[model samples]
Target: MLTPSLMHHLSIIPDFRQAWKIKHQLSDILFLTVRAVICGAEGWEEIEDFGHEKLGFLRQYGDFESGVPSHDTLARVMALINAKQLQTAFADWMKACHDATDGAIVAIDGKTLRGSYCRGKDKAAIHMVSAFSTANGVVMGQIKTDEKSNEITAIPELLKLLDLYGCLVTIDAMGCQKKIAHQIRRQGADYLLSVKDNQPKLADAFEAAFPMKVIANYAGDAYTTVEKNRGREESRYHVVSDVSHEFQGLICEWPDLKTVGAVVSFRQEGDEPPDEAVVRYYISFAELTAEQMAKAVRQHWHVENKLHWFLDVAMREDACRIRRGRAAENLGRVHHIALNYLKGETRFKGGIRRKQKKAALSEEYLADVLAV
Candidate 1:
């Protein structure tokens, strides 16, 4: 089997410590940290313990020279490492592992690490914006922001780093800016940006085109889908309308605007009548069919349902309270790397939690996960 590319990427991160003062290899500590995080390590102490327990297994892939470092040493060393370089290294590694298929939706969203907040200090929790490739079922890259409102500035920076050619990128209302649209198109990718009251004229145009007060009489393509989940049934009414000549002048500010899409969902609870219909509008550069638009909209949630939700629940990301320096940010990337490795391992027919348990208990299983 070929060696995992992640191992090679770890070497590029610079070591700030003096050469003679360094005890554990920077690469070895990183290698141990990522591997341990994959096998259920939550914090620095757990990672250090994992390193000591799995020293023999880790030695096969990395040289654990001078034995495992203490939890304090690991935390202090990692906190000093540049978080941006760590993000880049893992992104390059993921690029090698997966291919970008056509028509795939690369969903961009932000999540805050709630537990990273320091009560006594002036430190606020850190928020992260991430690009998740639904086709690859793994995070392509992530950028840290100071707060939720910073997503506007962070989205463009994150888009500049990704390989989005021949793909459809989707972002929520927060990312629906003309500059963001231009950048996505400039990268040779199409964008499906949500339209909300933030853009008053654009929202009005969509509302007039697909008015909820009037009966459905759109001239373009349409598709419907129904399903039940979490004790509720939802019927989605999807419509893709061509940009008529009247609104061409209104939407000319947006780059390469092609179609306007809407998903009106009528939902009902158990043994009750359907509640108020929720309608959402989107502007897309791709001339997507109604079915394609529906799939794109649904897949946009993959970043949340698959990435953020899993991190908080399966990985206990919100539960970790280590906020000294950039330790939380560096370890956050390790969580993504570990998730990619676990997700890439398809041979085991089990969930993430089960796979983590298996890897923790068995050396062979851990090796198999790393071999990915």
Candidate 2:
């Protein structure tokens, strides 16, 4: 994984001549935004301030032009730089991060930046669809929506840009469309999607097909699993049972949904287990035993804990208000880049903002972090 510290060791610029000749080389743009991210910059002006203040150190680092690119220069270059090109380069970075694991769980999710909106715009939101690798702790790439379009369209475009072979792609209810399922399968990947109201017919059918009553009485494929943890006083017991296709209604319309499964889990804390248990239904491509399927389902949450939750709560991404021109899209990419760096760091566990603050305070760490 391209940890912030380790990535600092790599070269950020590949074409020196091209980098030098450009109005603003890619490295200056990349490093500048990285520095701003490290320093808690939320807008182009803040980034400009950061760059002007750190000119000496930045010049020594050797990625900028004659001096640092002015705030206007930075804004213009970012506006002109094709979002697709930057996205491609970002994908390369993500590939490096995912290379550590033979096959990682890459979650595709969307976030709407509520603060990024023009004064009179109709939707008043910028939708960003991103792919995050749980195994490597890196974000693959992100694309922006001009209006309030469905993720169905955005997810496919994002998927088409990525290499999905050997990795399991996880999507929420919004991404449970048939085309997406087919797309994942076509890309040599397996999908584990949540059953919900978005695909109401299919979800209802799957539920009816694998009802609790059917599971309670039937003698079918069954597995019992247990998990124990001491630090948080967590204990879990799961019973995974599968049902045949006999009771399936609309589930039959879904491609390759052979077995309908249910996992009933009970958790305990403090001194006793909770009286109310949690039951989850899953549709799987892999014919995993109930135990294995349960594990994969649980691991899927890492995307929320490791990616979205971190970006929103730790990085304060949704709270940002950089909505002019391509600033919304450009800054979103910067957030992912910083997130990739932080996710790679093994030493920090406090949160992204704090870790970034520490990096800004220590020149050695800052240089060590953004070197590459």
Candidate 3:
């Protein structure tokens, strides 16, 4: 059963519509939109259609005395709602549902809403930075930026909103900055940041510390895994070493730097000339074994595979064109809520697309999804 407290989160969202002109309850509209989205509703029209068909199921949670609002009403109200309030409520709700564990992997990454750009209006595509808990497979929180390059600043703000104590935060090379590393440590969490040309000196030092010759013979700490997929075989080789002494000068520039690690990948596809190998380096504050570092680095892709990929492929996020006011941003939040609910439902035993189809075909299954 959905508790009153869980429902209260939506109720507390400050309604922007004036009291005298209000025809429908704010909570009712939000509740309807979220439930409809969970059952595969994409836009305002589809959401309105879902509400009309599933009005009976919706009323089980809240009063629908005025009935489902029109698509225009849904769109207008959603556009007016504050995105920050919605994000705060979403983070709070996720925390209530999933108790984050110490030392859990939290992958931080960003995705661009390609369809949000408007040519005539000269609007830019929206970029959102999201924090995903790999352990729970749910988005902890997200924040939006006008440009992808702003993620360096937006990441610290998003981190400030999350309760990340004791979590191992992993970010891509773009996020590897001194301030971001300091912010993560200040939050009482350790960080694993990828290294690339973005930080030229640091990258050069990392390369110097772990030369290919050193990796060929060094046997201090290492982990290797082989994977086969779609007529291709790939092997990943991970190695870690205590480079504090070797790169003492460079370590001083970073925050809480402890160890440097490298990941080398080799792929052979369809008997074609073996593809050239690729190697990447990373820095971490945690004193982890090569296996642990390898696992953390491997698991970081959960944000890409589980959350971003699902949003683009399963939910058609990249195709959405709602760019009015906060409509695009708010709708993105609704999608996250729906994704989290679907992910939490273990009994479905099917992929996300199949579950969405089932929810649309069966009201009982839809109710089961909302019951959480």
Candidate 4:
């Protein structure tokens, strides 16, 4: 059964439509859009079509006294709605659905909606930074920026909206800023940030601390894993250490710094020479063993593989062209909401694409997904 609190959560999003001219309720339109997107609707027209076809199903959750609105109405309302307000409500709804556990890994990353850009109007594509709960497989929160370069500033804002106490946060090299690290620490959560030439001095220090000669003989705590599939073989080597004593100069610049780690990856494909090995370094505020570090680092890609990949491949996020005002940003939030719903629905034994097809074909299964 759909709970009243769920409807109440959706109702709290501030409606920007004029009160005297309002025809459809804000929650009704939002609820319809979320359900439509979950069932494979890609644009305003498809969403309106879904609403017309599933008006009875939607009426079960929200009042549609005037019936489903037109496609233009849906687009206009979405374009005018406050994206930040909708995002906060979406995050709150996610939190209500799943309570994050302490020590859970929260991966933060950014992706651009390539199709949102408009060359005719000189509008840039929309870039969004999202916080995904690795353990829960749900997006905790997201913030939009004008471009990829703005993620450094937008990440801290995204972090402030989430409940991060006791969680371990991980970000890629682009988010490996001192201010971001401090922000994560201040939120009562630990951080594991990838190191690259973005911070040349820090990267040099980490590389110097884990020299190849030292890695060859002085192994304190090490973990290695190998995998083979489709005639391709890859191996990852992770070594972690307490570097406060040796890298004191570098440690002083970071907040709550505890450990330094390195991951070396080697790969070979079918009928090809072995690829050059790649080495990545990370600094963490948590005291983790090599095994834990390896697991956390590997799990961080869940944002890309699970969230971003699913958005682009299954949901066709990069193909969307909703570039007017805040429509694109708001639609991205709707996608996240639908994605979380589908992810939490584990009764069906298939991937997201299969489940989305099932929802489109059967309203009964769609109800089952929304019930969660």
C-alpha lDDT of candidate 4 relative to the true structure:
0.88
TM-score of candidate 2 versus the correct structure, residues matched by position? 0.80
Tell me the lDDT of model 2 at 137: 64
Instruction: Give the candidate number with the greatest lDDT.
Output: 4
Reference-based TM-score of each model = 0.97, 0.80, 0.96, 0.96
Residues 15-118, candidate 3, lDDT per residue (tens digit)?
Answer: 78789988889988988888888778889999999999988877888788989999999989999899999988888777677777889999999998899899
lDDT of 3 at 292: 96
**Residues 126-245, model 1: lDDT tens digits:** 998999999867999998985445899999988877899989999999999999999999999999999999988898887777786532665568899999999999999898877966
lDDT of 4 by residue, 169-234 (tens): 999999999999988988999999999999998888877788877776655999999989999998
Residue 178, candidate 1: alpha-carbon lDDT: 93
Residue runs of model 4 more than 4 Å from their true location after superposition:
1-3, 147-149
Q: Per-residue lDDT for 341 in model 3?
A: 83
- Taking all chains together, the TM-score of candidate 1 against the true structure is 0.97
Superposed model 2: Cα runs more than 4 Å off: 1-23, 60-63, 100-103, 146-148, 216-243, 247-259, 263-280, 348-350
